[model samples]
Target chain A: DVKVTQSSRYLVKRTGEKVFLECVQDMDHENMFWYRQDPGLGLRLIYFSYDVKMKEKGDIPEGYSVSREKKERFSLILESASTNQTSMYLCASSLQGALDTQYFGPGTRLTVL
Target chain B: TQLLEQSPQFLSIQEGENLTVYCNSSSVFSSLQWYRQEPGEGPVLLVTVVTGGEVKKLKRLTFQFGDARKDSSLHITAAQPGDTGLYLCAGPSNTGKLIFGQGTTLQVKP
Candidate 1:
């Protein structure tokens, strides 16, 4: 079984604070992704990384950024947290394939109060 | 744009009942996958269908991919309380990024 570990399960931050969500995968997958899941809207992609020092913006990457300094770890950054940014964040990784299955982390539920 | 659209955004049923969820799309995909997610947890992969007109079964669950590879369905027989969760369908987008449908949340009461 593959393991995708996230740094936090629940988080709360004040407005204007910087937030970081860390993820590590032990599956040696080449693709990593960040998505925010909300009611009615479902999961929307925020950012993704295919390799070290590589990042691509997803459908919704306006106020978020991603870092992949190493192959096994990817991090999501919220430059300035806001009330609307409060939602569940998910991280996933997949092997090098166009149709490969993505393994997901436990997810981080962030609340900006 | 989301490539897949799931039906019945929410479903609640009694244990031992059967239900079906559908994932429909206009564009063809190389493959599609189903995932089940519990509260406070990430979505977990349940099954993957690659070929058009393919059908895969996992115990009491049956999965079918449309002949055009643009749709799919999952039928659960003899459902249990443990089957309650958010069921999601995902496929690869044109840009290589994965696209997800508005998942169907199922709640089964015993």
Candidate 2:
């Protein structure tokens, strides 16, 4: 089975504090993505990395950034956490092709206070 | 903007009942996928439909891709409590970016 793991299942952060969420996939996938899930807004992509050291901005990337130092690990960073950023953050990985199925991590529910 | 609209944002039904969920989009996609997410867990791929008109089945679940390649449907036959979860429909945009629908929350009662 394809396994994707997130650093934290839940987290609390204060305003202006930097937050980092980590993700690791064991499938040796070449593509990784970060998404935030909101109540009515659904899941919005924050950022995606196609390969090591290569990243692209998604539809909603204003407040978030991603790092892919290795093929197995991807990290999402919130420069300065705010209450508006409190949501469930998800990490997903897929093969190099567009049609490849994306495997997702359990998710990190962050609460920005 | 490319968007997928899923109908019946919420569903509640008794065990042994059947249900169908729809996902429609004005934009075309190369492929459409269905996922099921349980509480506190990430979404899991249920099926992927590539052809404009295609049908795939997984046990008690059936999936169909619209002939126009802009829509899809998921039907569950004799839903069990284990089938309760959030159902999501997603498609790839022209740039190969994944676009997701709002999702449907299904609750099957025993």
lDDT of each: 0.92, 0.93
TM-score of chain A taken by itself, candidate 1: 0.97
lDDT of 2 at B10: 94
What shift in Å separates residue B24 of candidate 1 from its native position after superposition?
1.0
Expressed as tens digits, the lDDT of each residue in B7-26 for candidate 2 is 88999999999999999999
lDDT (tens digit, per residue) of candidate 1 on A16-69: 999999999998999999999998777899988888999988899998998999
Q: If you assessed candidate 1 against the hidden native complex, which CAPRI class would it receive?
A: medium
By summed lDDT, the worst window of 10 consecutive residues in model 2 chain A runs over: A93-102
| Best-fitting candidate, scored by TM-score | 2
Which pairs of residues clash in candidate 1, taking residues 3 or more apart in a chain or in different chains?
none
| Chain A TM-scores in order | 0.97, 0.96
Candidate 2 local lDDT, A1-113, one digit each (tens): 88999999999999999999999999999999999998656688899998999999999999888899999999999999999999999999999754479999999999999
Q: Give the runs in model 2 whose Cα sits over 4 Å from its true position.
A: none
User: What are the per-residue Cα lDDT tens digits for candidate 1 across B1-110?
Assistant: 54789999999999999999999999998889999998778998899999999999999899999999999999999999999999999898888777889999999999
